[model samples]
Target chain A: MEISTTKQFDLHRRMVRIRLFEEAAGRLAEANRLPGFLHLYVGEEAVASGVCGALNDDDHITSTHRGHGHLVAKGGDFNRMMAELMGKATGYCKGKGGSMHISDTSLGMLGANGIVGAGSPIAVGAAFANRYRGRGQVAVAFFGDGSTNIGAFHEAANMACALHLPIVFACENNEYGEFTPRHKTMAITDIVDRAAGYGMPGVIVDGMDVIAVHEAAVEAVERARQGGGPSLIEAKTYRYYNHHGIQNLGLKYRPDEEVATWKQRDPIFTFEDRMIENGVATREKVDEIWAELRQDIETAIQFADDSPYPTPDQIMVDVYTKSSTTIGTKS
Target chain B: MTRTASIVGMIVNPNAGKDIRRLVTPATHTSDVTKVGIVRRAIVAAFESGASKVLLMPDNHRLAERASDRIKGDIEVLDMPLSGSRFDTIAAAHVFCQAQVGAVIALGGDGTSRDVAIGWPDAPLIAISTGTNNVFPSAIDGTSAGAAAAFVASGAVCLSVVARRSKKVVVKIDDRDKSLDDLALVDLAFINSMFVGARAVRDPHTVHAVISCVATPASTGLSSIAGRIHPVGRWETGGVFVRLGAGGRKVRVPLAPGSFTTMEIAEVRRLGEGEKISLSGKTVLAFDGERDLPVSAFGTVTAHIEATGPLLIDVEQTLVLAAQALMFDETARHISEGNHVY
Candidate 1:
């Protein structure tokens, strides 16, 4: 009941950064200024912002293909991320990894994955490493609804719960897997139900409500840090754009009314209203925050645009490591 | 070119039974799977009993939405942003009120009902027991509940005749000119606590006073603390006030689900109709078994008894009224003899 304005403002800042940064990427992609297909994190910004807010700087996380939000929330530098997405040398992976393979080892962000369910196992591995180090840190696996049906998710969940690992499996059930509806792909509506099969506590939260997701993540993170074993969190969310691009592909698979219904509960907009009502921020402050983020995102884009691309002669260099440059510093 | 038919509003609280009480007490977790089955049965019965449309409250778990697949009638999920709290319940009830719904069936415990009452105090409500606290709702099967709901909804049984007017405790808290008014269908406790954490009032030691709309020993909860000594009926004119502390008659009261504590009652008094009482508090107010709001230090918190609760549908009574009112005739007799009515 005691609403913390500071915590709320921090959460708002993180979400706005992701939204503005992704919107910038979207604008570039729409104008053909950016290359490659992007799985944008447009609607489901609350999941990343909420989960990463509850985590420590050293706490690890493995993100899915739609992962710009995760990286930005986890203290990722926007200039480096935009540069990487733009395939510049100043990018996170020196431009080779591009959008999907961005990672920050020092910040404990494992990587934004290209594969559907690949992050689960990596998060499990990170948790195992954290356990081996005897550190009280936790690792989170961020995946989508369709990813839960994969063999990797079940195997990782079983292993984590069995080993009492400090990990949280955060499922962003956005009702779609690429083009197909989730109901057509899976029988169970709630992906968290599978957590019980793996002998872990499953929590379902409204991913549109950042506070709900944040509270759930905080509880799960605390439980994992206290050696209470892994827990699964399923966030009921939605993606505003198409699965692969920013363009309107005119997909007939989704109902028009459902889209309108979800847009009514736009996380950022509703959260702004909630913040104002709860005395966390004023309308003026909300406007100021958005303006600031827009400016920040523009600067990052400029930084990426001015940077150099990967040179042809240096293709063999930094591709492999030890056979490579040292990790977590400029290559 | 179309006739407007009656609509039944169904509010299924997915977060109801699953709370911190599951950790503190051996409270039964109402799984989403169970909720789905209940909603399916309820929707089926409501349709079978002549309800035309049903509007479901949106939740993280698609209990009603999933159940809609099997329902062979008009169904729509209310278009609103879900906050995943009691605010969702209140908002849905408010929508249902504006729409002038024929009936509203809410699935949760007393807190769920309290939320609905706050939104629309006179809503024709059928509260089914699904969560931890058990004051407002009853253990009615989904089939019977759905049928009864439709009976009221479709004018097969009139709400004014079948549904009873329940008493409620009105709470008004004024702090720095911002006034918030809330209602409890059962008991409102002034708890000696700091914050409203976990929502449920589990610790009996932290409780100081209770004002009840219906106090019966059979109705298990904080109300029973007053109920065991001085009983009050659901259709009663007024409420009961009980001061909690030591040095009085100790009664074993069921506080939370699967947990009961011996509460020593210091004083008990009967409140008259529209009788207002002041609770001087730097305390947390637990309404209908959940810690709702915190009273600031030396804030003005006053409560009064009113007959402004929901139009509670007595499920069996509705069915019995239906049977006596010519429903147990040739159609029913034919169905009873294992033949189709139509």
Candidate 2:
């Protein structure tokens, strides 16, 4: 009820942008423009868009390998992202850090980590720094259900709770940590239950509904900023695409019927339908938004294609500690 | 007549008991070794090795005194009077210099070793792993460590050969009363999102670093930025510092954090000496891999990378020699002949 019409509409637009971005990335991969493997954030856009919307620019966030939506929702630039995927000099890491390692610290989006459950400790450490400095900063770490099974997660949670660090653990329970379903890997169905072990609040939200996720995130972010320590929020969501490439080819672990059932809850379509029914937006307005996003993506692609490759000499940089006096010289 | 050697300095950490494997006691198998045993062994080893003077870096428990009384060698074990944090190994290094110890041996994991190294770059150090993660310390027996110290004391191996020094960065925050341990070699940030604590453990937000020159293996901290960049150091030396401010905007880069999300970098600048990089707020500075002091607001932290001087012993080399002696060697014969086997 606290959400205004404009905020809800903005969330809807962000969710669509994430979906379209992944869809386009998948197509670009097929065209052989994007090198390396790509993980699409097709179904879990709501979780990223909603949770990220709850944070301010100064708030920090750590992401997983499937972090495009998280990055975009956190306000990452599309042109730079496309340039990076193309491995152009203009890319974020100057074409050095590809998909898995992409980070924009400016946006409070800590770089997405490749290791499963590896980003948790770094987040905890950041939260500890924030608390120690007495800064009103909060840290958010986004991972999947697969990561919850990691021991590092448990240790970090216990430590964060014990130390009263301001952090929010957003677990996107996509039911699969790769090919294996949650039931196969974990005993409990609800990942939020993991929070009880840390002696903190655990929340479960309908991740398909962006509003639900937003409300949950707002509550968690406020609590953390106010020095209420940490909380665990499990957003039940799913991935429409395969773990990486385009081949779903009949999920051996999950029945075909289940996939069909979850697709019915596709966040984009649900939000669109709700917007039209509630008189919040017309089909034309939604179409306009999509068109704008598509055009933006096209511009991004063009920018990346036109951007020159980094100078060959530029190859030997961004790795070690560079001194101010030693600029232009190879370390 | 054999002249007894005097122990110049002893840098003892009380936490070495946290990670010792005891096969003799089945009940306490794989548990933390008793702190008293560690202290006792360290002090006794120092005494027997001709340590006539000692400087102890004990925890708040005053564990150094208990170890001093148990030693048979006539040695002066003076406790390092420390203020501020007990784990502030940097402060303790100043104490070692004041004590005028010829060599300083530290007992801790990579972070602890890095801490001591940052504090006393020129002081000789012996690293012992007592922490969970260890990449720098030599996983050797305490007796071997003691023997190695004695060798350094006896002029068996040159001091320059025993401690190898790497390049270090010194951050002097404008008007601040402290120094930083490790500046972020890549990127540092303050994260605000929430996930499970462990799963979110990724790299540090590196604000200022001498990235164009240093390199290391897969570290969870700043050095991993070098790993992300094409292996430059193993092939050649290179580094860069990317400033990531508080914006989620993507600066797309080719390097991936691990195997997942693609990263967007902000701005990449070539660092040089005497370059003035001003930070907005007083940010906390971490070094090598451990968190250090914070930079206060209105405080300016100048990061400059310079070659550090320390003759460090290679664990691989020492292990090779130890293996030769234990299996079959002239050194082993001499040790046995001298009745040095304990």
Candidate 3:
């Protein structure tokens, strides 16, 4: 697939946004400013930017624990997301759902699941809804390589195929599932092979290359939308940060050399070089986008800092529908 | 030899229930999570009622499409382009009309149903309320609504016998000699506000509501205001017109969930069918509690009651008709013969 300049620029812009947001989140978490656990999507930016770029705004996506990249790629507002991470009342879910559970249903973002493989079933249900309604829209499930071992993922994959649900199960194989590496948990090297067991097409893509991932996703998404069954895409990528916000713990698990090697093939820098080489954008224009993204992230952080926390009295509210008289009442 | 198959059109608005009310008032958020479950139940019920095929309106969130995953029936999504606007609903309705669907089941609030009505004025509709201000749509169980829709679709119950043409308030621009093709099925409120701020009738005092259909006391929004003053049954021939302010008798009404406000009724009158009432001023006219069109200063806009809205299926009545017709006798007998009867 030929990558147009507009598409390349957009992909770069989205990757920059996710990277900047993740970096800012890392800084905040390190300083103990954020209220909850932060999973930075630093090195795995290309997978989100590429896959989301291939989807329409109406298409649904169920994200994993490391979901900020997915949400941002899907056009989520940085201000509300930052506010949510800070547990502010103005955030998504009214601060009731923090970073791990942030969702903007208007954008077709199902929600960021905190539990491993939890989003798979939700994605299946979303795909099912799409099929039942006869809406030719596809649902994507973005889970980590570790989530492949979870039963929900297998069940969801099986159900999606049996029902011929229009869904794409995109696994970000970032080498490590929390502290343990991929080899330690799974026997197979490529997780996409498991799609065969579910009677669906499985393909592998270079997750570090945004163009490759986007091409793969476009094909998978189109197939599903056209009534073709689900497809599993295994994107080979690596994470620069540790499992959580704590960078120290990450260093203890992965060696410095492996991290350095992955950084050398960093998605952002490689994409920037490709853009310049392909005459898509100048180095200065790419630098400008990076600078603009930094400023945007700063504004979002400031907005989150200024936003107030949820009132103590609001704790019981939003638990259920207000139309129901039985809910939230002391009977 | 083949039998004629029944097809039901399903439209689920993902943007439904996520309005400014959640942020402005104490109303709880009705996310896509709840809508997915409702759509699932509706689809299953439609299949159970012998619907051979279902046409789902494609939406941004894929609410209906996702719900179709588990259903084993032939489901076709309307192949119309979507702009992620209300026009999508209108386009989908047009497709359903062209396809000559047995009935259309709309999962949304008043706005969604109104859009469907605009496309096919006489099409049979089963409106399930899923939005903030839900006066037009009924809060019936999804499964029952689906079953009723299927009954009509399958010709198990005739549409004319179990359905009624809804009442609507037609708006006409007097100076421009133009009339809005869209009709408000429940209440049309002429607000004193200059602009359509937030697209909701937030301040109840600024509303001068003219309802074409019945407004029950149990309903909410501007319809509730009319319902409080004079309760009109659904089968009533006329409507109620109320001028709201702080000068008349104070009546408490719920504008949104968990949010109630007291408003005064300056004038209340009965508006008979085909009766025209004119309003001249710079105001935002809200249809079914959703502020849509704006009239300039000194502009005259007339609202007339019309009994030509879409045919709405009464779920209970349709189910009763199905039972009376022994629609499920064959399946019951089959199960009994197989020794699986409960």
Candidate 4:
């Protein structure tokens, strides 16, 4: 599929937004400003940007723990997301659900699940809803390669195939599941092959290349929406930061050379180069977009900082429907 | 080679009737079995009324699938790949809008219809009451509701002729400058509490009801309080605002099924459409019987009624028109003449 200049520009802009958001999050974590675990999606920006760019506003998506990039790519309000990270009352969950649990149902973002492989079933449900309603909307589940081993992922895949649900299980093989490398954790080298077991098509794409991921996603999403059951997409990518915090935690496991090699293929720089080479965007224009995104990220951080924390009384609210007085009951 | 077919969408919320009210009040539980049966009847009725396709929203319990299993029409059970939640309803609404479905028959109460409205604000809806607090949807037979929906969906009865744009309570947080913060189909209550625990307004003393459209005295829940005092008609252009507190006229109100509470009404007044009522205090604002927003003592929340809600399909009116126009008779005659129809 040939991508238009406008679409290419949009892909580039989305990637830049994710990168800037992740970098800002890393800085805040380093400065001890953000609470809870901060899993940065630094180098994995292409997968989210490309996949989400191919989706309509009505298409639902479920994200992983390191989901800021996915949320940003799906047009989530950065101000509300940043406030969520700060545990403010103005957050998506009204401060009850922090970074790992942020959800904006209005935007078709099911949520950012803290548990491994939790979002797969959620995405399947969304896809089922789409097909059941005959709306032809697709749901995409964005997870790490580590999540592939979880039972929920396999169960969801099998169920999706059996029901011919319109869903895409996009696995971001960032090469690591927290501290353990992908090779150490799983026997299978390519997660996409697993789709064959569930009787669905599978594709592997260069996670560092926005164009490749976008093209593959467009095909997969279109096919799913057109009644073609589910598909598994393995995005071969790497994460720049440590699994959890800004601290590298000694970087004792992986070879230093591997990190250097992956950095050389940084998705943002590669995509920017492609944009300029294709004459889709000028270096000046890309730079301007990056600069503007940086300003936006700064504003978001300020908003989060200025936002108030939820009051004690709010802790009991939103636990269920808005009115039951069931909170604080030991039973 | 080509045929135009009307599609009617059905959304069933299995979680609607299974609320805290089941444990607290004498409200009857609507089992998954009954919901499935209702959906099946609705689908069959829609097909009989010339709906060529029936689209059902998938649920966790396989409600829609089971309902459509024995049916042989163009029934498509939506693919919900994940576990069922309220979001599924909203997502299905978006799909129905995209598919240009003739009309939607929502099988739940106010909350279920609200979810559909959120997804497709102007969708033509046949809201059926199957939940505890049901003020928006009426207690109508599924078969009749489906037939009416089919008439609207298939263009046998014009939408304008059979439906009217219902009223909605548009809520604004703080200033009335921002976009509509939230909305409620029947009632918006400001409760003198901070937490939204259990989600239902159990205690009558905690509520200050602001209702749009009509609240029948025969109905139950918070809307009944307003209906009992100052009954507002469905087409009335304004709303009723009632303050509940001490040292006021006492009135017996049924807060839930088999649960009647005497509420002290401090004040009750009629507010015209577009007239803003500012609520400021340490409270939580409950919409459509569920508490959702928490307002600080200094915070101000504004609410006003507007004719911007979903176009509710009058089932009786639609069926009546279909009869008067000989739609049912035409189908019967066609069948008697051995004229095959899909």
Order of models, best DockQ first: 1, 3, 4, 2
Name the top lDDT candidate.
1
lDDT of 1 by residue, B161-276 (tens): 77888889988887666688888889899987654545667678888999998898887668888889888889878989999888998989888656788999899999987999
TM-scores, each model vs. reference: 0.72, 0.48, 0.51, 0.50
Error of 2 at B187 (Å): 55
DockQ for each numbered candidate: 0.08, 0.01, 0.02, 0.01
The residue ranges of model 3 lying beyond 4 angstroms of the native Cα positions read A1-331, B1-4, B174-180, B330-342
lDDT of each residue in A196-297, candidate 3, tens digit only: 678776766668878768767877888899887788777888988888866675257777977897888888898887567545679899888888888999
**Number of backbone clashes in candidate 1:** 1
Q: Please tell me what DockQ candidate 2 reaches.
A: 0.01
Candidate 2 ranges with C-alpha deviation above 4 Å: A248-251, A323-331, B1-342
Tell me the spans in candidate 4 whose CA falls farther than 4 Å from its real position: A1-331, B1-4, B80-83, B175-180, B330-342
lDDT tens digits, residue span A114-139, model 4: 99999999999999888889877899
Q: Write the per-residue lDDT of candidate 3 for residues B196-244, one digit (tens) a residue.
A: 4246676665676555476788887878888888987677787888887
Q: lDDT at A286 for candidate 4?
A: 88
Model 4 docking category:
incorrect
Candidate 3, residue A153: how far the Cα is off, in Å: 24
